[model samples]
Target: MWNKIEMKRWHRLFYDQLVRRWKQNIVFAAATIFFLQFLIVKLHPSEVQEFNEAQCADIYPKLKQGLISVNEGMRTLVGHELKLIGEKEFDVTGYTVKRPLLNCLDQEDELLHRTIKEKYFVKGNVSGRGFSKPYEELKHPYQTQDLLELVFKELRNGFYVEAGAWDSEQMSVSLLFEVGFNWTGILIEANPWDHQLGLLRNRNALYLNTCLGLTVRPQFSDFVFTPAVEVKEGQWMASMGGLSETLLNPDSIKLQCFPFYSILMAAGNPTVNLLILDIEGAEFAVLKTIPWNKVDIQVMTIETDLIGKAGISGGSQEEAREFIISKGYTLFKHRNNINPVTGLENNDLFIRNDIVKKWNIKFPEPLN
Candidate 1:
């Protein structure tokens, strides 16, 4: 109804207004999104971990409340406490009770190359195919540790891979076997001081001063190992190591990390006679990362209570049990031993089906 110029002017005005409003709306929306993102990041900063040795010291302070970093990550270094009174050379010829710790620097790699058959068969008291005697009950906190020792007592030079092997001998499931039976293997500890103590105690076994992990991804950055002030003298804060950084105090040390397979390779991929895994709460991750095809584990004693309790998998103990069974192992015993400190029932022992079949290893009458 209007003139041509008037119509054109009206159209232009309408189009301009529409574009301006649209632009303003878009800007508002974008600003809102940006503000929300900023608030989220600031309020709940996501954690990131890096595993660079060079960056280990530098990244500790920058780690948020919950963050970790790991890079590609062993050996027994003797502690100063156990002063070597006798000769430094480790010799188990007579099974002396008062033997001092020996430096395992040179002997670690050599032991890794030795298989279970070679060590136990050649050097051990393998009079029969396996132990024919009834399993004995020892003075151990959990009867399972002694039971495990008795199962393979006939095999000398037997090998064990103990994750989270704290103090080597103190409450160690494999300590009796190593000292009495002449077995040797690798002991992995996350705490630097404990690792040193492990080295001093376990001269026969190779000790690794690192944490075993599932993925190469770093877990927490700027993690300091700080235990609660109320922790008792003899008790160890399990969470102070590789389990959770949140509980660590300011004095905690950064842990060197590695994958399970990587650790096996470093240990020359020996055939594992026994695998004792108690890596705080990261047992699931370590179990998941194990290269089943590469090694033959005859017996495994693992802490199962923390399986899906934490970490990314959110997996449960039943799921963990099922997973282990799926990997050629049978749940032999659910010990359900309550940890003296935490009072949590966590110990579960599994035996390789093939080993049980081959050796005809029958379940002994329950001692408990």
Candidate 2:
């Protein structure tokens, strides 16, 4: 199976210090196809004859008949050509034929935890026993573990979309839902942390190593990630970068950028149960991009502390709160506590109005 393949080559590229210093955004196509033929368990590309101008139209029918095998690894790539999302439709004649060459030079991406249960994931609260999967194992900075369980009555096999998902394991608000509840979803993280302790490789979620922006389309942006730690003696890992409206230095690390709505569409627009944002104050802008009417997100948790911080989103928590409330979400839960250990701000959980109406969740009262 594709999931069984060991993605050592792919992980190395993502984690390599040199690539971190040089190329941050890996081209989409080559990332999946570079070693696919060699590693796809005896599945090789079905070669087709070279196409001249005369044979241009012939590529269409051959592609229709599965004469070529570029069908694999075309996810989240080529907006104009593949039409994964946007006004354009899949242009078999224009784009399908170039898969062979593009695959050779595509950037590196490896889908981890596919065809397997999430690591350390349990079927239920099987904690405290021998070889048991404990509850509340993966702790979020904002106590989302308790928040989620209380809200859902310990619901399992749910779905989530976690932006700023750091390293799948540490302080990830979404991993506990996956590992403890057997839920699977998306994990979006970007650079600096990706270089330091970022870019998930073990979690069962679909990993997108990109930054979220308030955009109508998928694009690249300069990710200004300042490492909160030192790499060596008298040397810091702080590289100059900028956020959406950041007043930072000229030098910034460029990473793959996409709007929140576009990313949901790229991920097949699944109904997101819990949308958690902890991307260092980029939450407001990213949240604005989600097409609230089309996408059904039941609940959201945002780091509200960074709202008024200069060089961040340049917006206040009131603005963020107003924007969210306007989107038909009611502030479902909030606790007053800036996390001491991780220094994480308190996350305000907002439940969609429709969901609140459907579930009839009353604050501080258990649902029967």
Candidate 3:
């Protein structure tokens, strides 16, 4: 009996040790998996691209191939060449070339180069044109020239505002400063990560980490942020309607109240010479909410897409036009013309009439 009892006690001890080891192993495995996932997310292309790939899978084959080709061409040519010019201090006097190599590279490159140059260079934003997104094969023409001209034409040195600034490596505000737009504006962003990045990129620009709604002051509400920070009720949320509840996981979202009007008022109420709005689908709501008549805004450029999955539409663009027109602003230029049948072109511009009359800017013949 004593021997049997001792044997049972030994077995119990063994079982406990085995359970402890199993639990430790399971914990270690879980930690390892979490670490790997973190590394992948941090090192991967971008959250936007990932989301695009996952959600836009069906359109990926058509859009992705073209986007990649354009991206490679642009990456090889534009930003790199500009950087080289800066490093070497080389003069870009009449350095224009419609290279066939751009077409021969790939369908993506061909589409990208054509769209980027036409939209960005012809309209004037940057000095050169290139693909804004390479991997996705989406050709985004940087209007370096238009941007430079605007910077030089309007602001020698003063406040500038960039509304709807979001988190995308391609839409860096630093590029504005690099091309010499005196960083004087309120950088408004809704997403936490993008807002944080904007703050990092533009040190001189005052960063407002909230969405601009129709309200005169920032109001405390809940916002739907992805992966990093879920819904918290304490953060300030924009008052725009028609937001996707599923994407935001509305249940877990949090809201925070903030003073929107106070921040703008504090930003010196400087005459806004140039305004760029690319706030996804919320552009119309935000614009409608603002007292544009009271503000001395000079030139406004916006992105208009016929079938934006994010709910941007022609109606929104028209509404924006009407709003600007009501404020005695005229349409200066329209760029990145897209065929509703084919979702190809990325960046487009719409300038105010007052800017056109003042600058004597000529519009490029509409591309068929």
Worst 10 residues of 2 by lDDT: 106-115
Q: List model 3 lDDT by residue over 122-176, tens digit each.
A: 1112223332233243212244345555433445565556655553234443334
- Candidate 2, residues 85-127, lDDT tens digits: the string is 1233332211111122112211211111111123211122223
Q: Relative to the true structure, how large is the alpha-carbon lDDT of every model?
A: 0.50, 0.49, 0.40
**In candidate 3, which residue ranges exceed 4 Å CA deviation?**
1-144, 149-155, 167-169, 178-181, 220-252, 255-262, 306-315, 337-350, 365-368
TM-score of each: 0.56, 0.56, 0.48
Deviation from native of the Cα of residue 184 in model 1, angstroms = 0.3
Model 1, span 255-343: residue lDDT tens: 32556665566566778888888764567766776668767789888876655443324566677778888898877654435544434
Model 3 / residue 86 / CA error / Å: 21
Cα RMSD to the true fold for all candidates: 24.3, 14.7, 24.8
Q: Cα miss at 331, model 3 (Å)? A: 2.3
